[model samples]
Target: MKKLVLQFIYGVVVKAFLRIIVGVKFDNGKFLLNEKQFIIIANHNSHLDTMTIMASLPRQLIHKVRPVAAADHFGKTKFKEKLSNYFVNTLLIQRKRDKENPANDPIHKMVDALDKGFSLILFPEGTRGEPEVQQPLKPGVALVLLQRPEVKYVPAYMKGMGKAMPKEDSLIVPFNCQLVYGTPQIISHADVTPILEKMQHDFNALQEKLR
Candidate 1:
């Protein structure tokens, strides 16, 4: 169906296109296909970030990689919903929910996906911001780690994407960009406070590496 076609385009064609335009490079990219569960965390800046990150991975792992996207943004329209689900294979979650019940928490859905053995691509910054700028880490990622502390946390940093596809523009510019995959870290703490701090620190370290 359409999903298969999009996946094919993403895995084959689009991946090549991104490499050519952005000059995508990988460090520690071997982790992309390794036999271990990962919660891939990166800074969100451009719409291209998701695709570029996914494209860097091996083609066969495309279906196994699920980007945690904001439901309100990607689920607003039927076409977007379909495209998000099929093309990128995203796990869309509502950002706003009842706070009284942990049963209704959206983080549970992410935890469930992790338990199902699917690798996740999470932007802990919550919303797209200026590329290379340090946005505060959202607690959602820390919440997931608190639940599944054993999952490998991979930090990725991207640069020049804001120029390629800025938040104020819909049209993409052909600008050179780079994405660097950093060493994976683990969270063994039950408290999410320290975990959030570590998430911020790891992301910062990756950004420093990019500079």
Candidate 2:
């Protein structure tokens, strides 16, 4: 039942809204349909970012893609939690960690999701920032990549989402948006610095492509 609902929502409703209503130009979107499992690292701007990415994915892969979202924000209320889980199938993680409980760590949870064969949509920037301005990516993404060195990581850049649905506003404005996907990379390096640098470089290059 859940799968059926997700298929309809993502395949019809979300896809129509993004493509017909909001107008998203997807670059290299075919690459996503061919992969079985992977990680999508994208810039954080508006709440629409996740939906845009989700809508771009092939309808068949809807059940396999899970966006990593903040537990505090998305799971704050019971209704919101149920709605997100039922519709978006988001993997909510605690932004604030408890040192005593290793099991509660966000990286561990993310790695676990990967181990289970679920592709993830990750916003490396911990939270939403100024429109079109990307903040420094947190180390958590590197940590997740380190644990799963074999998984392919795709760098994605979203343009005009901030103006379409800025962090401050609850209402969405109609605007043309662009989503660009870079070549996927498998980083097997042991050091996190080089991994992070590569991600940042790839993201910067993708952003430049849209400009």
Candidate 3:
């Protein structure tokens, strides 16, 4: 009952607030996927970026498409933690911390989620701010792709989100949101590095298109 109520609040009220107040709309949702092991590598510009991403996915997929949020940021406050766990279904991870393998607990948790048929929505830049222009990606995304060679890569570019909720602003600027899905690329075990580079290039291209 609690879960259902939370879902209603997030899926309906939150969606309406974003759409009605912020002028956000989701298109090309049919391009989004389920069933396959996939990674959604998106550009990070605003805090509200996740909503636009979630808006495009079907409800069932929304529950399963976990976002990889930074531990320090999301873990700083209890409110953020609870909200991420409940509304975003985020999979918070510590960055390059230990000698532990990538397949450690958090990675294993994600593997288990995917094993149960969930996908990931990750920002390869790791932090929210990239260059004013597009920037190079963090290796965490590459590591995940390398380790889980079967996962398909989908590059999604978002525009106007930085203006909507810029890093420096406390207030949000209402603007129409844009999200576009590019062709899916498959990276096998042997082609990890090149695949990652291609992923980076693809993301940059998509960002350029948004600009």
Candidate 4:
């Protein structure tokens, strides 16, 4: 019953909010494949990025996405934790800087989530940064891909989210934004550098497509 309610809120309420506030447009187009499971990586720009991406998806797909969020930021307060639980399927993980050589890597939690057959929404850039600013892809995403080599990888890019709600601001400014999904790719190489570079390139290309 709780899952059903949250799905309604996300697939309907949040979708409406995004349409009203940001004029969010999604161009899944040829990229929406038949694959049910994937590891989606996107460029992080603002708090709205994750919501925008999820809301942009078809309702069925939206419900299947489990966003990997930072625990320290989103789980700081009970209210925030409840809100996240009610709205999205979020897997909260600790920041790398918060613990050194911890017994359990947070990535393991992501692995568990994938093992259950849910698609992931990850920001390989790690944290929000200036829109269109180049940030190196973290190795954690690559490691996950290594572990789950059979999972499809999709690159999504958002444009205008930083301006809509800049990282420094709490108030949202009405702006038009686009979520572009690129073709799905399978990881064949053991080394992740080339794969990361290709994803970064695809993200940049998506950003350019919006301009």
TM-score of each: 0.90, 0.95, 0.84, 0.89
Candidate 4: which pairs clash? none
Residue-level lDDT of model 4, residues 1-211, one tens digit each, is 6557656776688778877766787675334448868988999989998887777666666666789998888889988987786677787888663235443467777777888877888999899999667588888788888888888888888888888889899888888777888888888678889878777788888878878
Query: What is the per-residue lDDT of model 1 for residues 11-123, given as tens digits with 9 covering 90 to 100?
Result: 67877787776565544465666658898899889998998888777766777889999888898998999978887788988886555875556798899899898989999
Best by TM-score: 2
Worst 10 residues of 4 by lDDT: 96-105
- Against the reference, the lDDT scores of all candidates come to 0.80, 0.87, 0.71, 0.79
C-alpha lDDT of residue 125 in model 2: 91
Where is model 3 more than 4 Å wrong at Cα?
Answer: 1-10, 77-79, 101-109, 130-132, 188-192
Error of 2 at 31 (Å): 2.0
Candidate 2 Cα errors over 4 Å, as ranges = none
Instruction: Give residue 67's error in model 4 in angstroms.
Output: 0.5
As a TM-score, model 1 comes out at 0.90
lDDT of 3: 0.71
Q: Where does candidate 4 stray beyond 4 Å?
A: 29-33, 97-103
**Rank list by lDDT:** 2, 1, 4, 3
Candidate 2 per-residue lDDT, tens place, 1-211, comes to 8877887887789878887888777664667777767999999899999988887877778888899999888999999999999899999999965557767889888998998989999998989989999898888888888888888899999999998899999888888899998988899578888888889999899889999
- Positional deviation of residue 124's Cα in model 3 after best superposition, in angstroms: 0.4
Q: Candidate 3, residues 111-167: lDDT per residue as tens digits?
A: 656677768888877667842445667666666666677778788888778878888
